[model samples]
Target: MTKDPTLKPYQLRQLMCNSAQDICSKGYDEESGWGIVDLHGAMEQLEANYGEQLPFNDVAMDAYYVNAVNWALKNGITGGSTSTTFSPDMTCTRGQTVTFLWRAMGCPEPRISANPFADVVENDYFCKAVLWAVERGVTSGTSDTTFSPNAVCSEVQIITFLWRGLNCPDALGRSELAAGLGEHYYTDAVAWADTNGFFSVTQSSFNPMGEGIRAKIVTYLYQSLGRRQL
Candidate 1:
């Protein structure tokens, strides 16, 4: 491409965002502001961070989670529901979230010998993920004998999983949207996630018990990766 090539509106938006990430506060969310930038910086930083566009039948070019899906695909975190479909709106399961996080962390081997949950068989797909999560304090199963991997994951559940995956860091601050939050095990996790811009579906309110669909889960994982400095 030429140095002074023109860009469409969506292309321009992506370029500007990726460029802002180049100069913004370290691991800070977008509300921190983009600071000052020029077309030169934007040009140089184009696609350097977000990577090239991907081919997903279910994901749109301008969807908020496009970057997340693309990044997840590139990093071997997911391969979509099929060769050309992502099934972004599918309800995410506890097993799927654990698997995604496990893959994002490079599919490391768990440090345990015996399987704790009868439901999480060694031959199952999420068995290793459950084990790895257990070793890291990310989860302790749904019960003494059941991992309940098939359970539908809620927004609070996924956020708590991610928070625990990061060793439960203290929130530097809380979002104003967190004012009326009810007392629950996930209250602190939601606060931390809100502070870091995890829940992108709504800014005015949060449904703590809402279903954690696939799109939201991937976006949260992507944002978590950014907070981890890549």
Candidate 2:
């Protein structure tokens, strides 16, 4: 089996800082990572807070995982590839990403009938969702009529989508959100993202245009849902 890399305390702190910043800039609430109640943190808290009295077991853990999975599934944010697994660790594809956001936006189910992308066939599950997002300016393909449906989504890319999906609400914009976030091109998007508490930057000089990872994504989503640390 492959062993996971062991990070030094300082390195782990840096990673958490980066993760927190990234998510906060995207409109999530900024909070200290040490005591933040993210999904993993929530699970650990459950174990610590109720383990002595509750019948916690693998079954319970499975139940919690399934609860999140079912919620996402019902909202069209996720779908089963097998009988009982969500494959949560798998990298999300662009199509899946768009679908997830669409569902997160209350599954608007747009009325459009045709997809702008030739590659996205009419019968494809993500066709309408992709079109809806594109038409609403929530996203644009890598090129005209070519919505790389199978491509794995990047963290920055997901943040951009989330920012737009929220209609660029009055949270923060790039210029005022953080300094040294790469070039000036993404300033507006970054500012909107920042004010909304989607992402954060530590050291007061970190770049905001960098890539995001799965942990950051999950954290941001959990925060966006206003989950508490019980």
Candidate 3:
């Protein structure tokens, strides 16, 4: 198109006005430089792209545990402590902890081995998991022949068990761990767990003998899986 050589001021103004109007389309206005803003439309489009959003009522959406809980759910690591409640604050027993790791590892059958522990009955749910752990050198027992299945496992014990289950990978350095975990048998395990992302960096002074809750244990297991992509 060519401009008229003798275009009048009024005509020129009209042309300019039309040109400016052409810059905007249906969904925006002059202020927005397109058409009208359609927030509802945008939201609907997003829902369509991402699928319908479902709410897990019991899990706190903004809590630090929400991500780990959700990841565990998605990966079949757990279905929560109950259908709707995770019982995050509840302390996990030794049997439950082993079972969690066993389940996460795909519940492999243990090689033929004698069940030396009297407390771990053959008919119990955790029996096979415990035997599997023992056969793989993941755990020994509470004692020579007593697997304290009901006892609350310590953080160090749990981390050590997991480390053994993962084939005992080398941890890089441990000057801080040595200082904090004086004479603690599971110090190396804690260092390994921390180095492999099982424990966060802020946990410098680890209470190795302290009881770990369900939420924290599951979070540790989930993070450990992330390190090796299991």
Candidate 4:
């Protein structure tokens, strides 16, 4: 059977808002001081105003933001300050993002064996968590030899990590993935992501080369945890 076209922008926004509300109701209280800014609004405005400026920005907020924040808040993936601000626009560092995902997955904290990166000292708090991610194959850093813990993670990086962490199965074949992905290092990542219904290349190309925005990362994580409804 032929598939229907993707949901319109408004419909996607409603889905996100509903999802966010459900998540907030599920014991994930909005912090007191931080402004619980409407990610839906931010996402919508970002798309309506900046669609042509960026690739990922073209997707509707409803399609992505509510789900992302819902999952992040519910799973303790992101803890807002007393002010209740999520700081969604702030660029996420590799260490910070990985820790959030680790906590969300209920992964245990293991002892650090050694500092793999020359720049990351053993005494660093993120050292063990970073090591855990590496050992688990959730992340492999920029290269075989370097972790780049301080680097700001992009939208693609975080989504790929989420996909790996969830152990989503791969797509049936190379043709199932978007064209040109066969040559990407994240070919398996995209294939697995698509097969699992986490996303679609037809609706929006995975853009694996792009950086992950905070809202998008949160949405993918929430979906990975199977908590999109709440």
Candidate 5:
């Protein structure tokens, strides 16, 4: 599926046979460390399953991005940047991105703590999201004492954050991961994110410092959801 970006989906039953065989052998272990399951294969399955169900009327997303947007909306992870428009190209704030992830994860409450950052008010919409990230080691503040919640999050930073939240899934099995941008600070995270379909095909550069937008971040989250399906 990685080699064929314009590919359509295969039936789920087609995947079940081999997967069931592996499960039978491995006793249904979720992290069996089996052979590399095609990340594209998982996405194609999801697209086939839910591509036509998108209810948003104003989103201008291309075909590749629609499924991810649909999945995010269907799961109540986002309500669009505006009432009707998704504004896919607009940069996402750290607070907004974290809150979107927190919502997608069922809005678990973090342990009570004193508000550590001066900017994050108790009743702010993303207050709990920031706190949860801190508590879970998903993020540390920009400085030792402050979380610039309104600041824009970068591609590499967000991917690394998501990777950490997922306990940093191994990157060795995927080809793109193994051939990542050499020795940059976000080398490993960019590798994992790329192979896992975090970045869209149009984005050729790793561009770790590039702007992380709402649509792209949601797509990464949606693709990560596919990994859980495996």
Candidate 6:
């Protein structure tokens, strides 16, 4: 809707499927790409967002993380790595992930507990974030004495944090990975994720221990924002 801002979603679907009036094919085919455009048909069919655009030069118009990044920025979750770069593929730290979630939840001040991690200093950027997370049970830290704020947050950890931040709701059904998966800290989180339509049909298993990238992190947040009250 950027161009006209008046076109409805159904009109856009019509434009995608009925715009093409194929001269070469009797029916839709892979080679024909639906058909050729019928501008008249599109004219017959026919509806508006935020600081949806980011200043990051690397971000494309069609990037999947667009809404997430925009939502994050509009709510002050991030300012990018710099004025002109989002670095969407960069690995996100545990500290950054918690901070993102904390910001998304409107930056609530921690009502209880002090910084228990020896590694987390009072002046650190993630210091308050860690405190809020600990008070809310979003995480317990890597150990009693270390927050490991700089550690690479893996995919499962991100899911677990998000789940706990929402009070660890139970899933009604088992995840597709239920049989192959063993018990772990994030098992229930993964199951809840699956119940919420987070995985694709072919995605039978997840690389839970793999590093979480900025793109995936934002995508998950965006999807959660859509599917859940949080």
lDDT tens digits by residue: candidate 3, 103-195: 766576788568999999888989999999989888888799898999998877788888788777778666466457666667677777766
Q: lDDT tens string, model 6, 1-230?
A: 65567544433553445345765544334466456666566554321132235789988877767656765665477868889998988999989999988876657677865667999988888888999999989998788899899999998899899989877888868776744578888889988877776654213346888888887777676566545320
- Give the winner by TM-score: 2 or 3: 3
lDDT of 1 at 185: 81
* 152: Cα error in model 5, Å: 0.7
Q: Where does candidate 5 clash, by residue pair?
A: none
Q: Report how far off residue 100 is in candidate 5 (Å).
A: 1.7
Ranked by lDDT from best down, the candidates are: 1, 6, 5, 3, 4, 2
Cα lDDT tens digits, model 1, 168-205, are: 88886966655567677888888888887675533334
**lDDT agreement with native, every candidate:** 0.74, 0.52, 0.65, 0.57, 0.67, 0.72
Runs of candidate 4 with Cα error greater than 4 angstroms are: 1-63, 122-125, 141-146, 172-177, 200-205, 227-230
Q: Which stretches of candidate 6 lie over 4 Å from their true place?
A: 1-52, 201-205
Q: Determine the backbone clash count of candidate 3.
A: 6
Task: Please write out the lDDT profile of model 4 over residues 189-227, one tens digit for every residue.
Answer: 666566655664124566566665565566566554453
The 10-residue segment of model 3 with minimum total lDDT is: 13-22
The CA root-mean-square deviation of candidate 6, after full C-alpha superposition on the true structure, stands at 13.8
For each candidate, give its TM-score against the true structure. Answer: 0.75, 0.55, 0.69, 0.59, 0.71, 0.73
Looking at candidate 4, the ten consecutive residues that score lowest on lDDT are 26-35
TM-score, predicted candidate 3 vs. hidden true structure = 0.69
